[model samples]
Target: MALITALGPITIDMYLPTFPDIAQDLQVSSHEIELTVSSYLLGLSVAQLFIGPITDRYGRKKPLLFGLGLYLLATISCALAPSFDMLLVSRTLQAFGAAACIVIPRAVIRDHYSTQEAAHALSLLMLIMGLAPVLAPMAGSFLGPIIGWRGLFAVMLVVAVLLIILCIIKLEESLKPENAVKLSAKTISSNYFGLLRHRNFMAFALSGGLGMAGLFSFIASSPTIFITQFGIAPENFGFFFGLNAGGLILGSQISVRMLRKHPSFSVLKIALLLGLGCCAIGLLLTLTGLMNLSLFVICMFFFSACLGVINPNATALALKEQGGRLGVASALMGCMLFLFGTLTSSLVSSWQTGTTLPLFTSLFVCIGISFICGRFVGRA
Candidate 1:
């Protein structure tokens, strides 16, 4: 479950170090290749939008296996892509296939566990998933120089194949027959609309999605900040990136502990305020021209840590009212995440100046707006 969940981050961050390499090799601007990230997120959102309701009707196992099979093919396509256009399309297909992995695990966890137990299980899984992005770029940085950037997709291909085999052998169906939803376009559309109409769900989903926007903004912007702006060596880029990922792990652990003593809603309030604080401070430093590498990394680490706290709580709260249709609810949450991620990632790239101000300002605005919106959740 952890490995599959981590695939999304691995697919994303592992390629960070190779942006310039891929651009040069493909005879395009680095910025052009960055569109692949946006396209992948867009594809991911599109896939989850449907996959959730499909899995709710069918079982977890079948849909997951089929998706993994497609994932393997898409990854291979990425490795063999002959042009930038081919790579972009392949990456989108890759995310579409991968979306099944990301969405199903949440529903699966929600299946057997209720309320608090589900939240804890999610936190534990998140702990493992946190390490994937942490190590991915570090690994990519070394791997890219050896076999070149295309080799990274070959690695993900191997992973997808292994996961397919593992799922076939070890995974079991979790959704109960009684809870099985009807398989129809009309039914799926209705369930999704119902979820959207729920006040608490909207509050948590939007806030969580915006929180993710902050993370994606940082992820998309970091390579440029560290390598291009600060002139850090490409090989060491992952170490700096890992700092923020590590913050996420630490914050997740903290949230897990806090959940023992407080409700998710209580923890969420603190996390939102603290995360916005980190972004605000970073913005101030950036505008003052004092955001050296160390300060920038520090602020981002806290920013990610705050997300670590916010994500699991928000997910738990959003699905707490899922009388059924856990798949639909989970799908909406994950879809919103990448949809927001796609928007934020595009903004970070498009807003690029020679300095860090745009990235900091963007992060501040995302978290600040999310915090305000979160406060309105569950109100009369």
Candidate 2:
């Protein structure tokens, strides 16, 4: 789970500093270059729909290896892409590969652990995984200006090869033969729909999804808000970004300790309330013209910390009810969360006001929805 989740931040953070260069080279608007980011997300989100079921039916190893192989190829394609359209297509394909890495690991964890144990493991996993965004962007900010954006893809290609080798050597089949669901559409639909009909799963999934949307919305707008509006240097963005990532790490670490004492729902509720308060303050600051880059970063840190509490708990709760359908359930939940993220991110990208308004506004709405969902759906 750590490696899988880390891949996304690695891919994203490593290439962000290259955005200006890629834009200038392609003779396009910076927003146009951002489309590549969104395109990758779209591919990742859509591919999870199929990859989940395939992994459930076939066992985790084959699909995971195949996806890594494809990801390697796609990374090379991204490095060699000459035109903007080619890069966009390559990014989308790359996402298909990355999606497998992300979705399968969660299924594996679910397969191996009970609900509380899964949450504890996921919290640990997140503690490690969260470091990627912190370090990756900093690495990119330094390397991007020197090596160019294409070189970042080369790094990803190398990482994919390493992952592939690791998978072949160390990864065992987590899904037992008897537990595997049939791959037919009929079986797939039945499993997926059954999971959907469960109110607890829906509640958990929605709560996590909304929290994720808040983060995604912030990510979509951060570059412009920090760079254009606040006049922060590109080299410095990573440091500030890493601060928020640190908060996430801190929160996840706390979850490990909290799970031993408190109910997961109680933790989730407190986290959501904290998130709502942080976002509200952020919005108030932005709307009232009191927004400073320092203040914004502080608010983001708190907001993301709350998310750290919500995410793993919600996922563990959602996966608790699935006996043989862990993969499909994971896929369904991943798909919905990513779909919401994609929509929220697109909205942030389009509005591009060079201010913190979009960031705070989106966070407020997402948290509000999450809080409401938690109250109604989070009951035992």
Q: Best by TM-score, which number?
A: 2
Question: Candidate 1 on 1-380: residue-level lDDT in tens?
Answer: 87888888889878877999999999999979978987888899999988898898898999999889888998899899999999999999998899999889988888877767777777888787789987887788778889788999888888888898899999999988888999888998899888888888888888888987888888778878999999999767768877877888888899889989987788888999999899889988988889898888889888888888888887887888885688889889998888887788778888878788878888988898789867666431
Candidate 2 lDDT, 1-380, residue by residue in tens? 58866887798778987888998987889979988988888898889989999998899999999988888888999999988999999999999999898889999999899888888988888887778987887778778878889988998888888888888888999999998888898998888788778888888889989898888887777768878888989767777767878888988988889999987778888888899999999999988899997898889998888888889988888888888888788888888988999899888878766678887888899999888887566674
Off by over 4 Å in 1: 19-29
Give residue 207's lDDT in candidate 1 (0 to 100): 83
lDDT, residue 92, candidate 1: 91
Relative to the unseen true structure, what is the C-alpha lDDT of residue 298 in candidate 1, on a scale of 0 to 100? 85
Span of ten consecutive residues with least summed lDDT in model 2: 371-380
Cα-based lDDT at residue 39, candidate 2? 88
Q: Residue 299 in model 1: shift from native, Å? A: 1.7
